[model samples]
Target: VLTTFDLDEYVHAALRAGASGFLLKDARPDELLAGIRAVAGGDAVIAPALTRRLLDEFARYGSAPTDDPRVDRLTEREREILVAIGRGWTNGEIAARLVLSESTVKTHVGRVLAKTGARDRVQAVIFAYDLGLARPSVR
Candidate 1:
């Protein structure tokens, strides 16, 4: 999505709505084209600088509690995996950190997505943030 709005709320909403990319309207022509192409190619894209700002916003204003029943369905291991995903860890990274095989991580991730009714990894990350299971890390 290309828009002038770059607020965290907008970004989060767009992602939850299945947007594959978010780009400011003022972005350079080449960058805009690249973002479009990336999204068309089935790759997600977010401006790096905007992502940093968005994380800072998340850190400042943490998610509120919700009564979503899906939260109760996760196994402890699945919860941990969700947190890792929220922290932006790749499957390989999560595998190494959790000392699980990549296939195991993938299985857990799929389970988490199914249980939470999330459309994809991005939605899972949002769900993690929404439940306060994950927060932006201080860097």
Candidate 2:
């Protein structure tokens, strides 16, 4: 369960399977506790990236999309950060583009990862692509 699935469909399947709980493989010890408690209480939990995709899929299939509080948690600044990350820009590049300090950009990236349940920038990039938050640049 500690493999590199940090953002894979298996995690969603694990939740649907009523497992005691499954962590993102990179979850900190403290975060693991929350997962255990959630499943122990018979609740299903999914990473934000997966949640977003599921909602999008539902919308695509003509069903009502699920309401996700995490989407609301994202600030306008964070949305801009995601778009930058989606563009495959390095933190330094993002800082320069947004006219923010590199350290501030790093902090924003960290917050985005935590809020989006993204294991790393790579996954966040993939999530952004999947959600159409950013288009792939011309090769």
**What are the lDDT scores of the predictions, listed in order?**
0.83, 0.64
Off by over 4 Å in 1: 25-43
Model 1 over residues 1-139: C-alpha lDDT tens digits?
7888768778978987887788888899999889888777645678876888767776677569677789789999998999999999998999999999999999999899899987667678778888887888777
Q: Scored by Cα lDDT, where does model 1 land? A: 0.83
lDDT, residue 48, model 2: 43
Worst 10 residues of 1 by lDDT: 40-49
Candidate 2 backbone collisions, by pair: none
Which runs in model 2 stand beyond 4 Å of their true positions? 1-69
What is the Cα-based TM-score of model 2? 0.52
Q: Give the winner by TM-score.
A: 1
